[model samples]
Target chain A: MPMNAQKSVLGTLGSRAWITTVWAVTIFFVINLLALIATVMTSSFGTRWLGTWLPAGWTVNWYASAWEEFQLGDLLTTTFEVVFAVVFLAGLIGIPAAYALARREFTGKRIVMLLFLLPLLVPPVTYGIPLATVLYKTGLGGTMSGVILANLVPALPFVILVMVPFVEQIDPRVEDAARVFGANTFRLFVHVLLPLLLPGALAALLLVLVRTIAMFELTFLTAGPDSQTLVVALYYAVFAAGVRAIQSIDAMAVVYMLTTLVWLLVALRFVNPTQMVTRAKRP
Target chain B: MSDTARNHHLPLKMRLSAAGFDGVTLLVLPAILLLVGFFVYPFFYGLWLSFHPKDGSVFGNYKTFFSDPFLYETISKTLWLSIPVTILNMATAVPIALRVRLMKNQRLLTTILVLPITLGTVLVAEGMLNYLGPQGWFNRTLITFGLISAPLKLVHNYTGVFLSLVITGFPFTFLLVLSYLTGIDPTLEKAAATLGAGPISRFRHILLPLLVPGLAVTFCLGFVQAFSVFPSAVLLGAPSGPTRVITIAAYEAAFEQYDYSLASAIAMIMGVVLLAIIGAVLAARSLFYRGPAGGGKG
Candidate 1:
């Protein structure tokens, strides 16, 4: 009896130690991450930063220079154009497909699901090479449309995957009720389904928007000099960092970070982050 | 009864609806068509392109890839970087997620963790270049505290790429694990405790078994993300040397060398390698218990 009691006390100490270790690691990670981000933020506005805990002087001139030198205004415009186009099209195409997958069972359903899952499962760079080849083959390569189309390969599927669960949560009997009330198929969709699906559709599209903005491999491969998005432009600035001011590049990095972060913040307000990956568990 | 009788007289849409190809079902076609055009077609086109290399006959690109040490070595190098990083991220995520699940401010913690993900690889790489640089705050703090005499070279090397992967990949792995952990009923753990199973035993006997399937998935997805590490590999690592991953090879082939066929071959190889890894993980997962891990609504 004494031994068993001693074992229990030891077990509690072990568990406590384990919990502390986990928290320590997590806090360490979080601190490092915050410091990393803070470094970039500070350097962006700093006049000189070399082997110091803090910069010699601070100024916002780098932001102005980065904006002008990188042509960020045009890049932001192009990015928004591509992102909005992809989001709008993905919603238009994906929501209806999600509704079908959720409400009805049919032949070849598994195959369809696999098709949607492939783009998400397969890394974009693996497929982006071939995709860029095909796009460049046709006249679409290096065009804004090409960027939008390449992005939609993943965005459409993502919307469908995220929305399918949302659609499934609505009872099928509700659709039947709408049908029995002398509603046509179009009317049933426009009036009855749209209202219920709006929140899900919004969540899905917002996510797609955030994803499109951040999607690098596809945009980097497919975009030309003229069609470069902000992320792609930022990549170029970093890649060819010898000529540009480091502070300016950091400023551009800050801009790119804020763009995606704002959308992600808004996205989190609508959808739980976990929902993004939950559909992966489905058979 | 009247509806059935009148169904035949209805339009082709109605007739198709009777066979389960309803208007709603047809809605899926546009998305399917898009995928077929962009994804399916490009994949096959790439395969076909791989067969017709620039210099030699069919299988030329594959032959070149295998024969050239520089080209072939990327597979191992990539696997070396990605596999370990994926494992580390998953391993770390499981414990942290388990703790976070029991926390009161789960959402806030999760949101903070997720910031790195939205920051994207390019920005993270850029940030790492500054923050982890010899002159950055990380080294400065260590030096100020007298932790080390000389500044560490954290960026522009393998350590740089590895650190960037953890920063970006950990949140994703954490989010997935947290979701899966939340799905398992807390009562099961309670039951285990009541049965005198210690916390470690409870986790090992109950949670680990339940989490294998989700872990397999998390690993694959995380592996895919880390495997195709491009921007960071280039911006943060010795891209031509240590971190010359398959994607980098493909990029160089297509863009730098302007060899589309070779690039296509490399891309195909990359895809195959990724699929093989994921397949193996899933297969191993089947060796574990595969049953409902949740209670209540699930």
Candidate 2:
């Protein structure tokens, strides 16, 4: 009753609650950012920010060490290679499938989408292990081909997910017009359908690239010694790299997170991330 | 033409449709085959491995997984970790997402929130450790505050793993849920208010029902994503105590221990359980969509 009595000028508990919630959220953001800043500063300065609220000085000691000595260059190249291959392959496969679902009527149209989602729904552990086993036993385990194959399971699904809407958004009659004019399926796709879907395809490519680049779980489990990814390398640095030395995981964390953040920003900018598909209206 | 004659024409169209489909299928066959061969086969095979054993019998591996308290802890711990992390992610992402979608400045706010989606799980886990781990900033701050006598233990613990999961998972939920929110027609809410419905009523009657399907979908997607999470679990999760997840056990079995049968079994269990839940949710959403406003298409 007293608390209710304390309802001030607005005569609304909801506003009060919302205000409190917003402030609470803001506090969360501040704390998280502060923590992140703290990590970066500590790694950069090799010192705490207690007395002055910020570090007195900064150093590039870790960056120099990471860039110069660490095999980050090689790992980065491998990461790029795998991500590029997966994106290209997924687009080629995804475009045709998406065009079909969009253009034609089929007996089991609904099930096709479900089938597309199958790879995504299946647990990573289930496939990653067997794939790793097959690759290793077959001598492709640590090879680029092996990593690229493993990456496809997830990347391709992501491609299909983004591509479906793109396919759906193209004017249905355009393809029909092409068909009437004697354009076969391949020409229609190559000229008419492809141009319309290309934006969506590009969006899908960006989406998959973001997902593939940042993904560590599958890469970690399936990657072989020579094929070890950047994330995997980062993993060893924390656990197997002698925790006491190696200039603190803080520096390494900054490097990994910052790089990922930059790439994601680029991806999100190109793609209308909210819609998940270019030119797609709400269904 | 009679209805049967019309239906006869429909079959022709359907048959003709196969040509188009075949082309599409041919293109996507590699991915589809890969999914079937790698994911589906392994899934059933993993299940088979659980029951049929390589060492001696099928039940033996599952018995090891279930009977041994250690193996069992992985499952329970994984559930525990997943529940909280999923809850935290949905809680933060959904409401902010709701508000963001309703606001004019959606892009700017969304850009900030979605930044973490770029950062991989390993990077996030590593970042959390660097920030929260012993000898990290938080401890240094506490020391400065005289709050603790020594640097606090943070990394390689439940707290570290949970925090990392929250950071990584929240952005995804926020982005997806926000998109779902944007799709709902705003005029309905305006009409509700015009007809004497309060904001809460508009939300409950109009918004909540619409949000139901999205909520269920987002929840399942987020939960499974969290459940299958690996990098953070290995990097930040306490291997022995406060944060060991089932994925870790499966990894160790498959890779470290060279026990494919056992690994497959564990993997199978995970796949089945996850699929079962997703399947159940999809079925529920489909049934609920019997009305005209069911989802437009897959």
Candidate 3:
């Protein structure tokens, strides 16, 4: 249908009430969300902000205090280490598995696919307790490696799920042609598949990076003092709130928000957020 | 025997490949092993731990959890918080997604909406404390506009937790519904319009049926996310009161009381409740039209 024709049809159908209500709801939600974030951002720089529309004074000292109080320098380094490790390891294990799952028809393929789905289906906290217990027994709990391993449970499956659709989209004939020209499996993947798969892999890993950064449950359950990610640290800071200044805490929040927002923006450039969910939903 | 000997003469890779474990297929092993070693094993371990209590018979933890109102009430508390929030998020998401699907600037709107999801529950909770607090901008503005005589008690209560869940969860629900709505071809609605069906009837007869399955899925996913409410419940909610959710109970059992067995039991119960709700929704989805939602060529 032509756009104007559809519009005429819609307009004549007297659906303006519905459209108006939707826009009202959406505007209401967006305005509140932005205001909430703006409140946090404004407070992070405010000198005093009690019972007032705006702060008495604005300063940047909270950032410095938050950095010192929260040990943010070390916290950021740990977060980056854990996030990168998860991204790297998930890619290494997940991409090839995705390729295989996408290309091949083998016995128990359904079962294999279900195995991947379960981790994503089950919330991390449901499993994180026992996993933490097991990690503690193995002397890995409260350690960086424990956090990394705990995170990979969801991250690896996410990578595989996201990459499967991407892998399936590749032309089989391309792989056949590579094989016909004397390419072995290794050579085929390296020379042909690698380049073709790069975009999808990067998108998947970038998403994994963003998810790992925000993954609080598993990281919180498994992390020790030194292994705590930024989100976990923020949770602790919030939970134990009396000692730290609210301004400094909001400053830490702004830092955390900026970190995730930067990565999310980068990720959105490569992938449509909605399409990613839809693709992952595919059987 | 002769076949086996001949097969044995080949490389191990080839031998394995003959049984359908080809080189490509074997790539899946590492991921499987990781899941097994981490996710699968731990789930069973938790289950097993739940059965064996530290101070009593095998069913001690379960008994304790059931008998204690404090522990058991968390179930109802959590369900009360999660179910309504999930329903509200999906209810709002459906209409908004329907609206956004027709708009020209869907991507920009979606990106803006998606900010909450990435900002996460903790940040949202933090912001809510300040934004919706007694002395915060929200109240000040409302009061300035003569909306209320006094600041409404929003944070550190059930209402605060509810707001936090909606703020963090609505984006996700919206995105999922939008994706599903977009997947349904616009021509279906157009066809209904051409046939002189009114807008409401066209939606009732066409879009509503197609959207049911997707709505069920959105409900389950959104419910799962909300049901696992942890940080928001603690930070934005009165954790010792109305928001003493199941996860908090489990955390207290494990960390505060140093009773891993009871915690594991609570975790297992949480999983079972979550799955049971999801299973019921999915089962109900079968009653609806289950064909391809899309009108386009696959």
List candidate 1 segments past 4 Å from native: A1-5, A276-283, B1-15, B296-298
DockQ of prediction 3: 0.69
* Per-model i-RMS: 1.2, 3.4, 1.2
Q: Between 2 and 3, whose TM-score is larger?
A: 3
Q: Which pairs clash in model 3?
A: none
Model 1 lDDT vs. the true structure?
A: 0.90
Q: Give DockQ for candidates 1 onward, in order.
A: 0.76, 0.47, 0.69
Scored by TM-score, the top model is 1
How well does candidate 1 score on lDDT at residue B286? 97
Q: What is the lDDT of residue A187 in candidate 2?
A: 97
Error of 2 at A81 (Å): 1.4
Q: Residue A178 deviation, candidate 3, in Å? A: 1.7
Candidate 3 chain B: minimum summed lDDT over ten consecutive residues — where? B14-23
Q: Please give the lDDT score at residue A225 for candidate 2.
A: 72
Deviation in angstroms for B286 in model 3?
0.9
- Candidate 2 interface RMSD to the true structure: 3.4
lDDT of 3 at B145: 94
Worst 10 residues of 1 chain B by lDDT: B14-23
What's the candidate order when arranged by decreasing DockQ?
1, 3, 2
- lDDT tens digits, residue span B1-298, model 2: 8866766667665655544555554565565676776556655555665676776874888788888777778777887888788878887776676666657766766665566656656666666765776656667778888999977777777877877777767777777777777777677677788999865677778777787787777878788878887877777877777567778888888878889888877776676667776777778777543332223343
